[model samples]
Target: MTLDDKKRVLREMVLHRRFEERCYQAYIERKIGGFLHLYPGQEACCNGVMEAARPGHDYVITGYRDHVHAIKCGTDPKVVMAELYGKETGCSKGRGGSMHVFDVAHRFMGGYALVGGPFPLAAGIAKGIQLKGGDEISICFLGDAANNQGVFHETLNMAKVWNLPVLFVCENNQYGIGTAIHRSTAVLDQYKRTCAYDIESAQCDGQDIDTVYEHAKTAVDFVRSGKGPYFLELMTYRYRGHSMSDSRGYRSREEEDEWKQRDPINILRDKLIAAGELSMADFTAIEKATDDYIENEVMKFAEESPEPNVADLEKYVLA
Candidate 1:
């Protein structure tokens, strides 16, 4: 990667890391309400693939670990933060909160609450594009647990049969709410599950951006080149618990530390430095700038944004 490319990737990853850290702090401080999930460790997984996506053409739908997707897809952090704060300026008009950030303009579809709910929605969008004769594609993100949902299998069959252009990405972070994939999932190798339908598939280290980006180029190129659909299982680990409430006692500290040692952000940081593409001073500036951007720009915007009016509580609702 060129210096600019490396910087761009790190910037996006840093934005996610900083933004999520602040969001978690906000949640704990009672500044933001509802269940909060942090996307700290899964940065490279979303950043890598999104780098290959075209915002106006391609689309994305994902489960609740969605803040990174929305951010990477060009959603304004200000509005996204506002959404989490339940303010009117929020992307979902203060209704979607942390789990449901949707912005139609950017083609980042709903941040669905259900585990496997987004699978069909992604397929439907891909089908719509195909029917319209538009050459666009949709990507779906899910945790390993979501693979157990029936909708996953159903979408796989439908997508493969109809040749829908959708990429199913399983962000397997090892644990699904404290249950290890081995204990919960019968087919531990999730990508191989797609063999039944003959859809193209792959698995990669989610913590390595280069690995993911390289794999995404091939997978995305295949799907974009009119291959039915693709499935990729990202072997990753989430440093934080499933939610803010999780005590995380189900896993050992040694295990968490092991994964943490391979933190995606640091991996890229060291790579760029060793390649002579980045300097320590440049990285320090990035760190300061990231903190400043979130504190002064996003956090301030969400903090100062107006809350939704009680009178409008019945407005966006459909009875």
Candidate 2:
């Protein structure tokens, strides 16, 4: 990556890391309720792909672990934090909580609750775009565990048959909750499993933001070229547990330490420093600023934002 590209990636990675750190702190402090999923280690997969695409045109949808995706897609941290706080100022008016954050302005479809809920929705969105002869494409992001969903196969077949402009991004973070991938998936190679539908697929290192960006860009472009749907699998690991309540006894400390040694943010920070593209002082200052932004702005915004009124309880709720 060029110096400018590295800078962009670093900035986003820092924001994601800091934001997630603060979110975890708030959750522990009892300021934010409901299930909270942090995106600390999976920053590269979300930020790298969003960097290579136009959020104004393309639609981005993902599963429950979506705060990072929303922030990267242009949703302010304030509203996002407010959502976690169950305040009306949230993206979904505090109704969606941690999972469902929908903002049409930035084209972030939502943080769907179900593992495989967004597959058909992504295809439907792509179909709508195609009918209008629009150039924009749709991105469907999910976890490795979601690939095992029946809807995943059905959606892939339909997308291919209809030649929809969609890119399915699977962030394989080794294990889903406590179950290892091998225990759940018969086809261990998530990318090649798409060959059954004759869709083009590839895999990349999720730790290297630039590599993920390049591969994701190509896949996004391929889908945008009016071709059928494409699938891109990213091999990554989450340093933290799957959720706030996960006991995490299923993995070993040595395994977690092994992945930590290859941390994406650390890898980029080291590379940028060695290439003379970033100084240690600037790195410290940048991270400090990100911390300040989340601590001061995001926290205060969520704190001051009013909770949803009981009288309006039925306002956003669907029948």
Candidate 2 Cα outliers beyond 4 Å, as residue runs: none
Root mean square deviation (Cα) for candidate 1: 1.1
The lDDT per prediction is 0.89, 0.89
lDDT value for model 1: 0.89
| Cα deviation of 279, candidate 2, in Å | 1.2
Best by lDDT: 1
Please, what is the TM-score per model?
0.98, 0.97
Q: Which tens-of-lDDT digit does each residue in 1-48 have in candidate 1? A: 466887888987888898999998899889888888789999988888
The C-alpha local distance difference test score for the whole of candidate 2 amounts to 0.89
Model 2: number of backbone collisions = 0
Model 2, position 308: C-alpha lDDT score? 86
State the RMSD for candidate 2.
Answer: 1.2
Quote model 1's TM-score. Answer: 0.98
Instruction: Supply every candidate's count of residue pairs whose N, Cα or C atoms clash at under 3 angstroms.
Output: 0, 0
